[model samples]
Target: MKKYLFYVLSFFTLFVYAQDRQLSLAADVWPPFTDIDGEKSILSDLVQEALGRMKINSTIETMEFAKIFIEINSGRFDGSPALWISDEREKYYFFSKPYFYNQLILVGKKGSDVSAASFDELSGKKIGVINNYAYGDFDKNQEVEVVSDLSNQKNLENLLSDKIDYMLVDALLIQYMLTYQLNDVTEFLAIGKKPLLVKSSHLALGKHVQNAKIILEHFDEKIKEMIADESYNRILELNWIKADVDGDGKMELVLGGNKAGTSAPQNIYGLMHDNSYKEKNPPQRYYVDGKLYETWDNIPNNYKLDLVVDSTPSIEDTYIRLDFLD
Candidate 1:
């Protein structure tokens, strides 16, 4: 009886430990994705939700960008939800499927006479870029004088002040900042039509972690399920939905509010407009979503709610309603 009791107790303890197991994660402050203080991070939310579905818990720690790679490789943290997979990192990490696509573009002031379809065309010019950012073609270019900064805002400020002839930044970051952080700065900046760099991002688990392969497999399954169920879109809380809102069998780009991941303007359905001024005042206006609402107070209780994913439309072609233009 004594031996049986001991075995039962041991089994119970093992079960409890398995139930309480958690994955420790770390990432850098990539805004519109992860935050510095680890608050309201969209990527964090998606990762946590996916892990939770697998009955696995996680804790994310925000750290310096460069340090995240080194520490995770050294087994300091379990993994990162968002990382660009590379040859060096592949040796020490198990990477999940691409969850995010990052497009790096060049931005210059309006009518500055700096036109280039490729980075090579801008040789001998001074360009500002985020320090530690892995820009494939833009990095290690001896022809261009590369100015390093820690953030996009700093680079934009440098561009505005003529400290740099051009600036490089993630396309999504630029749009998010224009909508939420730097509304006034939008008028003076013009994003290049062509992207300088494009890469897919993934969740990387340190090779040192036990059962990392199985964990990554489960993560991939859960994340894909989230997208199918539309839970992934909710986690992003973006301003636009790519679905066909007009029932015309083609997807029409929709805009939501002043910012993504925030409440839309009260009783307003944001509609996209033509690029009348190019970079200056890319047109956006508020209209009624379901029922025509001229005032916020008159919005109907039965109006349908529309949600958007984190997909940007191509500048060359997009469906827009001219009647909705303000």
Candidate 2:
């Protein structure tokens, strides 16, 4: 048994180190999350910090979104920080378990009924979408007129001017906007409560990369470590998120600041939405300082102070801003 264990450990070690310490990744200009310049980007920070802990030095090359796959297939690049999975992509990409998400929700002018449950109900309405994005089969419905744009900024402009009935938006970008600047402008924008599409964001490496499986395994482990240490929230620059900080098998409203608001946060971000996929309404219990609180009202007053964000977020506070196409 001792000899068998040694061989197994050696095999694992060999498998993990097959690649060099260096990694070359690429992405397009997906703002707040990732960008071409790779500055003050939340997703980039998460990727760098996670890889840094694994002692893997890395560089991200930014190009047109279409070019990312081209470079990866030719072995000119290793992988990307943000990519959505598909059937064909599985053949060439070794994907890490999603570190976060990109939830597309419908947005309309304040007080507009953006609550249509499905595209079938949205027939004949004009919808704004980013060109070349995978919005499932949303663009296929004959009655729906799909308007494509270069960026969300253009879509927002069009929406505000009544050029389009509704626009699909990523929840993370909206959260980032509210967290930083754009809080004032949001009063004019009414976001739908339900998401139109919830897509997972993953770090993907070409299958041809050496030890791609082991590298992703290490990355996934690092993500868990970062979440446990609160470094994930710190790097993400969010006030808090919903997570199971303690190993008690229940979720808690994990705070980054000294205190959180009294009310149960309406949209406390979750690190992974995979749980929501399984249980439509998962039990959300709170754990703090080693105790579990079943109800928000039952919690002590000291732990529930309102978190006030500045009207204008600073560079030191969060990632890059998606300030109106202004």
Candidate 3:
């Protein structure tokens, strides 16, 4: 009886020690998704909570997107929340089951009539692309006008100004840009009926990390459980659902009123014209002193305004602040 008791105690002690092991995560500010605003990623939060329920602790470190990938490859971090599973990457990383899917799209100006029936048709056109981004087969042997900075607003500006014929960008990111930054001057038309590339994103474990394969297997099982129990869907709904900020059942905010200042008066007023609120809404809003502020700079850098609202508010306002990192 004493031997059995000792065995049970040893098992419990090992379990406790395992539970206390911290899982290090590397992430970047990929908006409406992963960001480093005090445990603010919806996917990250869900994963963290799930880990907690499984008796694992995790600490996320936010860094540049490029650096995050580099660190993960070099085993400086244990894993990253979302990364594409590619052949080149497979050599250095073990991937969990895909938790989300995304598409790479070709975005052109609204009125541009430059649709190509096939990939072969874009042979000579100056194609703007983020440096080192894998567009699957679409990127193979294609001549591209590479933009080293993928998230820079200037790349879109160049596309709008006709410096480049078309730019390859993430579909969701293009939608966000149209809703917020490039609404006035730029619009995106799909270059082809099919996506330029379709890819799945997974939690990637570094190759050099000890027991990486085993860790990835555990992560895979957890993800499967989350999906089977419908927890994954709940997380998606929490992050992706369009929110109506103006109480219109639509997601738009109309700002054209008497209070709009003269310098940028027409710009704000134009938002309300022709019932634009019926269309898509902004993913987030910036407000100060009960009045909605338009631009990022409008909010005093020091005061830290009243509210920074999201399409879906996951964490408390004090814990997270939203800004266009790109």
Top candidate by lDDT: 2
Ten-residue stretch with the least lDDT total in model 1: 317-326
RMSD of 2: 3.7
Q: What TM-score, computed on C-alpha atoms, does each candidate reach?
A: 0.65, 0.83, 0.59
Query: Which lDDT tens digits does candidate 2 get at residues 1-326?
Result: 99789757754763466444588999887776777562667888899888887777888988888888999999999999988888778888999988887778888877888887678889989899987766667746789889988778788888888889899988767776665556544677788776777788889999988777767877888887777666787887776677666656666666564565777766666666545523567546664434567866776888788787556656533444544533
Flag the better candidate by TM-score, 2 or 3.
Answer: 2
lDDT by residue (22-85, candidate 1, tens digit) is: 8889987666577644245667788888888877778888888888877887777889888877
> Which candidate order results from sorting by TM-score in descending order?
2, 1, 3
TM-score, structure 3 vs. true:
0.59
* Local accuracy of candidate 3 as per-residue lDDT tens digits, 230-266: 4553554321222233344433222211222222212
On TM-score, the leading prediction is 2
Ranking by lDDT: 2, 1, 3
| TM-score quality measure for candidate 1 | 0.65
- On a 0 to 100 scale, what is the lDDT of residue 293 in model 2? 71
The segments of candidate 2 whose C-alpha lies over 4 angstroms from its true place after superposition are 1-19, 139-142, 161-163, 179-188, 244-250, 274-282, 289-302, 316-326
